[model samples]
Target chain A: MTWHVVTGGAGFIGANLVRRLVQTGGRVVVVDDLSLGRREHLAGLADTLLLQLDAADAGALAAALRMVPDGPVEVWHLCANSDIQKGVTDPSVDLRATFLTTFAVLEVMRTRNWRRLHFASTSAVYGDHGTTAIHELTPTLPVSNYGAMKLASEAIIRAACETFLDSARVFRFPNVVGLPATHGAILDFTRRLIADPQRLAVLGNGMQQKAYLHVAELVDAMLFIRDHADGPHRIYNIGPEDAGIRISAIAEMVRSRVAPAAAIAYGTEARGWVGDVPRFRYDVSRLKALGWAPRLGSAQAVARAVDEIAQQEFCRYDA
Target chain B: MTWHVVTGGAGFIGANLVRRLVQTGGRVVVVDDLSLGRREHLAGLADTLLLQLDAADAGALAAALRMVPDGPVEVWHLCANSDIQKGVTDPSVDLRATFLTTFAVLEVMRTRNWRRLHFASTSAVYGDHGTTAIHELTPTLPVSNYGAMKLASEAIIRAACETFLDSARVFRFPNVVGLPATHGAILDFTRRLIADPQRLAVLGNGMQQKAYLHVAELVDAMLFIRDHADGPHRIYNIGPEDAGIRISAIAEMVRSRVAPAAAIAYGTEARGWVGDVPRFRYDVSRLKALGWAPRLGSAQAVARAVDEIAQQEFCRYDA
Candidate 1:
């Protein structure tokens, strides 16, 4: 039996991916600091070993790996400082959480001679490319510290794969959304409407648009690419084919689902925050060429995520 | 007067750049850890302030910046782990020295509101692109920790420029050779020949080819780009127009100059070391378009560097 190590595995996408891995009968080990990842997310998964430790600490990570049974290990390195605004406020947040975590993991892999690694990169690495469709070949000029660190991690991983690793896959994620949503537009809107049912204050002009992929579909594509990709190192953009949904549409969807009577107000700024990229288009043709694509489009993914978040937060959906 | 802060200013390229900055009458401050950078490199330069501290230490760097007189500042971030083999042996060497130094400098710049920056990037960021003439737009897939960290630094700088910096110029350097040499093929050859004086042992198959640029010309292009570049961020590959010089030819050049009777023996590997890129072609069209070019070709640069290294090493030229 192969050991599947998932960093940040107690978080949103990680938890979802963990469920899939468990269902596939893989012995899974989760490395999470629990700073952002909730242990309850993996509550029902009795077979998975949860190592509540910082992934950036190589010593802790090495100890965790030692606890696992000896076998071929595949690491799903999804660990990162997901909050872009926090990274903008404190660059070290991303530097340590995102970039250092990858570094530590790669170092461990090198020392142990363990090979396979699947990394969660971000579309933010493309920066504000405007409307230009970002393919795998897009010039990565990140605008945010979070994006910068993620790009840095990718570069390091690329180097490791070229030098030591047997193979590594880097998936540049679009905005991921689904059940057990920790933080994002849908969750933010849902919580706001829950607190003040009469008012919904949205960030930016609500014109910011971005592609979204449901967590389940994202997991499917990750596994598909893992089994199919046949190179020492590869990078693929994983996202829906649609252009994206505007922030305004997402706000309305959440408000309508949670509280239809809420009055929505928006900030005049074009972007949501200091490091926000208002718009981008992901040309996931590379992933598509491997005969894999997300099951839901951006709008449909957002719609499903809104309902899922409402149900997860409130235990029931009024709509 | 404008304050010019050069990290690693006591090293080869940095020392040369400091000499030029002093000649131009700029108030210069140098930050070096003195680990690889020799303090004597800046001897007799009475006007320059030297801060013997690690550039990766943000607090130390910030304190050093405060010591300088209040004025507009230009940070020439040249500090890095120059030894590729050492970085390959210990990844943290590059991570802390190369990547963190840039991060610390940018952070200090952001906090102090001092914007101008000139980063010493490397052609290693391009990795082993084979014979492809690497332009600024070429995909950067670095294969060495040194190269990876440099790429990471570039990404962080790019983000900083997009967010906080007034302007930044990233110059991708080819193999630089000149007087006051710290490390490189020519210096290695000279030192080895000096020690043995009979047989010269060459790393790699001696077929490894790469562009060489004299420190004088590199300093010239750096200042030229700083003065002429108009954008918030710009990247230029600084190298000679010719293809490059082979390792065998360089070995011959050094052998002929240092030990005329020495027999050269080459390693079987194509690359000098694990992280070494055996060959690369730098497309200097970007810098050329800016109306700047290196005065010496690769062969000429190697020849000049050979004589300079011999003089610096032996205090006289035998050739």
Candidate 2:
């Protein structure tokens, strides 16, 4: 019987992961800062320990760890700076939220002699790998501070694995989307259309393309890797087999579902933002070797996510 | 006129770099905390500004930067946790010293609009690459906290370059050894032998082999890279052409020179320390491609370093 500790447990993908872990009859303890994570997301989960505290705070982290029974603990580290754009104004956000949180978590694990760790890294760590499908062995040269911090966190986790951790799994996630989606392009597009039914203003030229894995598929793949993957340290690029869908294609899908009458407009700049990697591709052959693949492609994932988020938000606003 | 800023300037490699910059008639500003740096190392150089401030302190760093004249500024980021062993006891040492210092420097640079940067990274960032001569594209999987912090610093520097800097050079160094030497295997061995000449206990079997670049060669390669390498960001492996010398061989050299009568004893472990990577080889072809090479091989470098350190310490003791 493994006790699962999921940081950022009340956030989007985190909540989905928490639900899956709970459904599997595993004892789950959720540690969240509530800065961006909402408690409402984890509602109705019984016999679960939910500690509202920042993972970067060592004392709070240690206190949260105390709640778990003395046994096999598997850490699913999901806490990170979700607001990638915020890194430009607050450079320390990524460092503190992502890197520091990981350090604190690894330190606690070291002291407690708990070993198994699952880190949620990002494809952004590869920065702009041009048009080539970045393999796990690709030289990670992150351009954004967010990506830099993620890469930093991954390095630390790898170091900890060498030093103390019995096993470690680092999954480089693509743009993940699906139900209970808190943020991203689909959510943003849907919200904008809700605000102005006739006009849809999108950032950049809307040509940016990248893979998107649904949260359900992401969680499923993670579990599959945990059971099957062999390693003291294993890094896998987790995404769909397809190249990915363009932002313009995603916008068309969102507009069709949310506001069919909306006229799409694009920004002058080709990139959405300063640090935005307009194009990225990653090879997921490693994960596929383990017999894991996303059910939906990038465009399909975006369409489904737009619908899910639209339904949830519209029902709330209507009520 | 080029105005140079070298963080950790009073320390070993930093001091060597400052000397070269001063010789070139550049206005050099050195920021050091004196935590491990000795002011005596920079005694002969005149017209050089030495600020007793930690690079990690944002306020102090900004205050120190104000003293420098408004001109062409090139930052040589060498400030780091000199003690790799210290990371084991205080896990935060490398993070605060190495990673935070780089972050603070980059922030200051970004704010001041400083465009040129030279970051002193380490080959330890490559971790245990087995016996292969690791290229610049070698997958970075740092095993030590020190190595992880260095890798983190490189990632941050690269990110900062992409965001702000016009040009950046990231030099991944091997075990650099030379005069005014503050720390490392040679200094440790010499001090231990000086304290007790009769019995010398070596860490591990000391089959631990690694490359050693002389401080002079390292400084030379850096300047060469700065002049020849063109890039928004360029990463070069700075070391000798030949594969490195083993710890046992280094121990034998030190024993013969410092204490011929000392009985050598070995630790049970194969590695010197917990995070110690026993064997690592890096290809210097990248640096060599630019017509740069180390004058001394690994064994020769170690022997010369042992002599230089031996003479410096013995003279002080005699006085």
Candidate 3:
């Protein structure tokens, strides 16, 4: 039987991916530090082994892999420093969490002769391309340390594929939303409303806009790309076709669901934080070419995510 | 007085750059680990201080910068794992030497408020583009670990510039040749012929071709770019406008200068090594537009380098 190895597997998107993978009846090995990923996320999942360790530690990752029975192994490299703001504050965070994790995973794969790899990259790699539609071929001039490390990881992965790896797929994700939310605007807004339901203090001017994809749709596209992508190395920008919903719109969605009377206040700065690309447009034609499309648009995804997160966070109060 | 900080000042190109900086009457701080760089390379340079330490150590680098007297500082980051094959053997070599060094330098610069940085990037970052004339805007997809790390460094440097840096100039150098050669085809051929003058063993099939630039010309272009370039970040492909000279031709040039009687034996593989790009075309229009050009073509650079290296290596016989 094939083993699906998901780094950061118990985290938000990783957890969603793990849940899907488990349903497919494949034995899964989850490697996560659990800094943000909770053990409860994968509570009912069977045939799953949770290895709590830093994914960037090669020896630890290698040791974890050794415990798995020898078979066809595929790695879903979803582990990374999810907080872009933290990375801006300390560049080493992304260097270790994002870049080093990818390097360690690739090295381990090279040593063990494991081939298939699905990498979770980010749209930030394109940096601030303004309104220009960013495709897979867009020049990656990252503005943030988070994007820089992701681009670095992509470069190394490409090199590995060129030399030793059988194949690798790099999925450049836009803002991914939905379930088991660790950190993001949706989660942050929801938490803030829960703490102080009278006012929703939004970062930036609330005009910042970018594509969004639900975690379920993201997982589906990933699995679709893996099944369909036929190349040594492939890059796909996975996001909705629309330009995206604004932060103000997302703020309204969260505010209405969490606290209808909450006054929305926005920061004067156009960007939320340092190294934040306020706006971007993703041209995911390559992924669309493979006959895969998101069921929900950016607004729909945001709306659905807000509902999911509000319920999840509010449930704690009811308990 | 303005100070020039060269991270790899004891190495080949760094030494040459240091000499030029010294001639301009600026104080120079030479930071090198001396693993591959030699102290003798920067011999007799005036107003220069040598700090022997790995460039990747952020604390050490920060401490070294503190020792230098306060002044207008410019960093020429040239230190990296020069041996592509070594990096292919062990990826961490380039990770620490190339990528981490850039990160460390950027962090130190950010802390010290040192704004200006002239980075020594590589054609390797362009990877195996085949015969496509690579421009500064070329989508970089590096095929080797050396290239991967360089590309990674470039990404981080770009991010730094976007965030805290005043300005940065990234010079993507081709095969740099000429005096005090540490490693390359010319140096390798010269040493091999000196050991066994009967037969010259080549790594790859003789047809592999790529642009070459003399260290003198490379240094000249770097200074030229520093004086001319503006904005937060700039990248220039520094090389001859011509496609390049073949490796077979380089072999012949080396053999003629080092050992005229030596028979050349070629390996079947087109690439010189595992990570070798083998062939590439550089469109140096970007550098040329700035009114800078190499004094030597690919063949001329190779020939001149062969003569210089041969003389340097063969001087012991005359003594």
Lowest-lDDT window of 10 residues in candidate 1 chain B?
B310-319
- Which parts of model 3 have CA positions greater than 4 angstroms off? none
Which DockQ-derived CAPRI band holds candidate 1?
A: medium
Report the TM-score of candidate 2, chain A only: 0.98
Residues A1-319 of candidate 3: C-alpha lDDT, one tens digit per residue: 6788899998999999998888888889999999989999999999898999998999989987898766568999999999999998899999999999999999988888789999999999889988899998788899999999999999999888866788899999989999888899999999998889899888899999989999999999999999999978899999999999999999999989988889999999999988899998999888989999998999999999999999899886789
Model 3, B19-67: lDDT tens per residue? 9999989899999999989999888888998999998999999987898
TM, chain A, every candidate: 0.97, 0.98, 0.98
> Which stretches in model 2 have alpha-carbon errors above 4 Å?
none
Comparing 1 and 3 by DockQ, which wins? 3
What would you estimate as the lDDT of candidate 1?
0.90
Error of 3 at A251 (Å): 0.6
Task: Give the clashing pairs for model 1.
Answer: none
**lDDT score, candidate 3, position B230:** 82
lDDT of 2 by residue, B24-69 (tens): 8888899999999999989989768899998999878998799887
The native-contact fractions of the candidates, in order shown, are: 0.67, 0.70, 0.75
Kindly provide the TM-score of model 2 when superposed on the true structure, using C-alpha atoms: 0.98
Q: DockQ: which candidate is best?
A: 2
